[model samples]
Target: MIQVKQLTKRFGQTVAVKNVSFSVEKGQILGFLGPNGAGKTTTMRILTCYIPADEGSASIAGLDVFENSLEVREKIGYLPENAPLYPDMGVIDYLNFIAEMREITGLERKKRLREMIDICGLEKALSKQIGQLSKGYRQRVGLAQTLIHHPDVLILDEPTTGLDPNQIMEIRQLIKEVGKEKTVILCSHILPEVEVTCQRVIIINEGEIVASGTPEELTNKALGGQTIFIKIKGPKGEIDSKLNNLPGLVSFRKSSEEGHNFYRYEIKGDGHREHCEDLFRMAVDNNWILSELRMEGASLEDVFRQLTAKEK
Candidate 1:
């Protein structure tokens, strides 16, 4: 339950976010995506009350962020881009400190400490000092600190950054599991990770809101049409010419991979999945041997690039 309306943040003359607006529904994982210097972290900071916006308003669970920051803090768990961690504090000790800061009761302090230890997989590192742990374990320690209070919303800025591939996968799985119960806004530069973790996405660029929707919706709208791929065991030059001359076809890409011909034809066929026959007929007319064919929807990456570039 998070809402940001016309949210604008600026550092003097340099604007970090401009007229950015979006909403996150309860128990939903929203992927906040952008390239570097795209203001993703700045937006997250505004939502978490780490910084104030130049204009507009933001709310968490209906509590106004600017006016009721304390209450909002009580309801959110923020893991910043680079979480501040004491190098010498023991893992459990750091969590204990955060628990006290969150004003957890004596019983909750103990109970939540146990849960954080288990949920974040910090037991083995509990007695170890934070600086001595590996990057992955340190990340888990950061997660433990954030979850110490059992907040309702999680604002994670690149939760898997800097971790090895295995560690990144582990943390991604953990985020998905957490999202099943808590509203999550996952901000990351890794596209595949976001696609796997969030069903909805918001793309921002140049301090403005570029696109927002489900992955499928974004792909469909960005393509502004439809796409299909076809493969034929034929003379490459002839196949290329046939596709290039085809009408209603937006574009075509021909390739030969591992001795097999491949072609991706962009078209505005209006949901007519029967175009495979058209490609087949063209192949027959050219006396090209038929090998394999497939039709695919536009990809999320393609949509993201299209929308962001268009806005630029």
Candidate 2:
């Protein structure tokens, strides 16, 4: 659980974060998104108590982040954009060192280190030096370090930055696995990753909170965006009038393919799921053959662009 109210940060006259607020429920993977310099990293640093906010307040679980930074640290596992690694230390050895730092000791530390190594698929690189690990393995090692503490919350900033396509997918799967029972706030520029992994999203622009909701909720809240395609063998004007009978109906566009015509209807968001059956019945009554009908929902990328475009 996490909460922030009008959280902001500034450097001199430049505001790095401005009045941004959002919450993450337990076991929820929340996508934290924005363009470059939109305060994602800044906000994350504040939440993790790595940096203090200049104004407003943030709390994790039940304690103020600034007031209880140490307690908050106990509950969070943070992976910054550039995760540190001991170049010469062996992978397992480095992880063991971090384990000891986290106050894990004796058999407990050893067991967690083994589990983390297994979870991150680093068994083959157990004895390999950190510098010998490839970039992807290094990222996993960073993740392993974050999980070695067995934290309740994970704050990952650009977790999959330099990996290839397969590597990215691998990391995303790893994130999904780890997010099962842990609260996670993942900051990423890649739209698909968020769409795939996050149940809810918070979009920030120019340090202000622009949008926050489930992907579907935010997309549907965008008014004036109902478009349905109809494929039927009715005379053009007749098919057009039939659809126009609906409430809040707008103009319809007609296109032809072979002998059939497509009547594309643009209407208000009228919660009209039943319109499909009604339209089919009318088509049959008029002796018109029906072929295709479907609703086109807005893509997440489109929503993101529309929500953030005003910053320009």
Candidate 3:
């Protein structure tokens, strides 16, 4: 539902985004990830038509964002990092104002307002002034205004930034539910949240597209191969010799030596199950006590660091 091609943007001599390109299919939730000053917000602004790119093109549902700015705005709901809100207005009144601005009136507006209140869990705060609400509730109000128009695409930047753990989970679940029907572009610094909430990911660094794929795919790319952690009780020399001769053993290192001949080892290899089996067989044959044998795969955070870390 969204497409960007060779998108580049600059402010003075600084390049905010360079040759960035990616696409989101209809009903897909894409996670846009980057560290601070990585042009995440700038790219979102351009996609939402809040700003124009200096070079390349972007389109929403085939409508050029630059040429058809107004039309593109109609199809997108944008909740910026800091939600634009009026402190003095009551939650319901603010939603009503947004509805009016969106040309939603009468029965249609009423229905949408009711739906947003329920969907955003804003029933108790409707009568309260926005400024009086907690950060979580205030965020809900922002989301309500964004959804008031039922836009096809939702561009949310740090939707759960300041909320407690419970509030973060609630917002994540809400976004997951909304994503079933609408295409979503979610920008978050929280890697775990993105891994759970988004179907695919795009990582940008230094204003360039660094990586793009499913969370698992990116994790595998970062890890290169599987890692196995094992804790065994045996003679150090014998254990080392067995591990060194194991098939598919890429690398092995003794992590620590505990009391009573127990040792912890980290082993890296190509075939995951094959290596585990070899370790098990060796432990049994050598009468070694195997306490822990587990596979450790790369997490989204690992992938993020691997792709975005500064060059040495």
Candidate 4:
């Protein structure tokens, strides 16, 4: 429901986004990730029509964002990092004002207001001024206003910022429910949140997209191998020699030394073979007691750091 083609933007001599292109299908939630000064917000601003791109085009639900700015606005709901709110307005009044601005009136307006209040859990705060609400409630109010018009697409920038763990989970679940029927582009610094909530992820760096894939795909792509952790009770010197000689093992290091001659080791393999069976046989031949063995892949955070970190 959203599309961009080689979108580029500049501020003076600095290029904020360059040749960036991607799409979000209906009912899909996309995680847009990047480090600070990486042009993530700039691209979001262009997509939401807050700013124009210097090159290329963006469209929402088949309408050009630049040519049909008004219609495009009608099709997408944007909740910026700092929600645009009037601190003095009560929650109900604020939502009503936004509904009116969206041209929703009469019976439709009432229905939408009720829906937003219910969906955003804003009933208790309806009578309170926005400034009086807690940070979590303020975010809820921001969400209520954003969804007051029931737009087809949702663009959220740091929606969970400043929220406590409980509040963050609440908003995360809410976004998942909304993504059941709406296209969503979520921008968050929280890697775990994005890993669990988004269907796909796009990582941008230095004004360009460096990676795009499912979490599993990106993790595997980044590591190009499997990480194995094992604990064994044996002579440390013999274990090290055997590990070094294991075929297809990329590298191995002693992670820790447990009491009673047990040691923990981390091993890396070339992703082409399994080492557990070989290690088990070797341990049996040498009468070494094995305690722990497990393999893990790289995490989203690992992939993000490798792709976006400066100095190559």
Candidate 5:
């Protein structure tokens, strides 16, 4: 439902985004990840028509964001990192104002307001002033206003900022539910949140897209192979010999030494479960005690670091 091609933006001599390109399918939740000062917010602003790009093009549902800015805005709901809110207005009043601004009036306006209150879990805070509500509640109010117009696309930047663990989970669930029908572009610094909630991810660094893929695909690409952690009780020389001879073993390193007999080892090899089986068989053949053996796959955080880390 969204497409960007060769998009570039600059401020003075600084390039904020450079030839960045990606697409999001209808009803898909895409995670946009980057380190600080990576132009994430700048890109979002361009997509929302809040700012124009210096070069290239972006479109929402086939409407050019620059040429058809008004129409594009109609199809998009944007919740910026810091939600714009009036402190003195009551929660309900604030939402009602948003509804009116969206041209929703009378029965439809009241219905949408009630629905937002229910969907955002704002019933208890509706009568309270926005400034009196907790940060989490204020975030909910922001989300409610964004949804008040039922836009086809939701662009949320740091949607869970300032939220407690429980509130974060609640908002994640809500986003997932909303994503069942609407396309969503979520920007977050939390790797685990993006890993768990998004269908696909685009990682950007130095104003350029460094990687894009499913979580599992990116993880595998980052790791290059599987990592096996094993704790065994055996003679050090014998164990090393056996491990060295194991098929598909690319490298091995001693992680820790537990007493004189037990040792912890991390083995890297071709990503396959058979490697673990091979380790167990080798231990049994040598009459060595196998205390622990488990395969560890690369996490999203690993992929993030691999892609965004500064080159030596």
Candidate 6:
């Protein structure tokens, strides 16, 4: 449970975040996206109370982030892009220190420590000094410290950085599981990970929110029309004629011509099944060999680009 209203922040002459407002419901995993210098981290820092906003207000779990900064920190597990860690401390010792700092003690502290080790896959590196660990291990340690307190909210920025593919998937699944009971704000440059891990998305650009919605909703909205690719073996003139007359076919263009009368075409239409069905039936009726018929839809990456790309 979080809410922000007209939040604004500035550094020197540049505004890092401008009149931005959004909310995340309890148990919801939100993907916070943006290109470099687009204010994603700025927003998260404000929400986490790491810095004060120049204007506007924000609250988490019903407590004002500014007024109750300490309490808010207690309720949130924040893994910043560059994790603050002590390289001299062993993984287990550093985690213990964090547990104590979080006020967890005795049996509960031990329980949390073991849970973090297992959940973060730090069992092998328990005795290793943090500096001796690889970057991936260091990331795991950062995640462990963040979750050691079982906070109600998680603000993770690039939580999977330096992790191998297997480690990435493991962390991804762990985030999904944690989101079932905690509010999560995942900020990352990896679009596919966000597409699958986040239930909703908010894209910020030039310090303002450019788009916000479910992944599918954003993609569908970005798509002005359906794109279909088809390859057919037939007389080029006859095929073009039939395609032109097909109902709901917004437009078609021959992309290339292969040998033996086969041609590839790019079709744009309203994208209803009827249009595709009509094309299939047309090919069958004309006895034209339909070698390929596939549809392409806008992806999260496409939507991100469409919304955030700058003009020269």
lDDT of 6 by residue, 1-312 (tens): 999999999999999999999999999999999999999988998999889999999999999999999999999999998999999999999999998888899999999999998988899999899999988889889989999999999999999877788878888998898899999999998899999999999999999999999997787667665788999999999998988888777789999989999999998876454556777888999999998998787889999999999998
lDDT scores of the candidates, listed in order: 0.81, 0.83, 0.92, 0.91, 0.92, 0.91
Error of 2 at 62 (Å): 0.9
Q: Total backbone clashes of model 1?
A: 0
lDDT rank order: 5, 3, 4, 6, 2, 1
Candidate order by TM-score, highest to lowest?
3, 5, 2, 6, 4, 1
Candidate 5 lDDT over residue span 231-311, tens digit each: 999999888998888888889999999996999999997764478889999989889999899988899999999888887
Q: Is 4 or 5 the stronger prediction by TM-score?
A: 5
* Candidate 2, run of 10 with poorest lDDT: 263-272
Question: What is candidate 1's local distance difference test score?
Answer: 0.81
Per model, state how many residue pairs clash.
Answer: 0, 0, 0, 0, 0, 0
Q: In candidate 3, which residue pairs get closer than 3 Å at backbone N, Cα or C atoms, i.e. clash?
A: none
Superior candidate under TM-score, 4 versus 6: 6
Off by over 4 Å in 1: 223-227, 232-290, 295-299, 307-312
**Candidate 5 similarity to native, TM-score:** 0.90
User: Comparing 1 and 4 by lDDT, which wins?
Assistant: 4
Residue 26 local lDDT, model 6: 92
Q: Estimated TM-score per prediction?
A: 0.82, 0.90, 0.90, 0.88, 0.90, 0.89
Score candidate 6 by lDDT: 0.91
RMSD of candidates 1 onward, in order: 4.3, 2.5, 2.4, 2.8, 2.4, 2.5
In model 4, the runs with Cα more than 4 Å from the true position are 233-248, 254-263, 270-288
Cα lDDT of model 3 by residue, 1-312, tens digit: 999999999999999999999999888999999999898989998999989999999999999999999999999999998999999999989999999999999999999999999999998997799999999999999999988899999999999999999999989999999999999999999999999999999999989989999987787657656789999999999999988888888899999999899999999877444678888999999999999999877889998998888988
Runs of candidate 5 with Cα error greater than 4 angstroms are 223-225, 233-242, 245-248, 256-263, 270-274, 281-288
lDDT of 6 at 12: 96
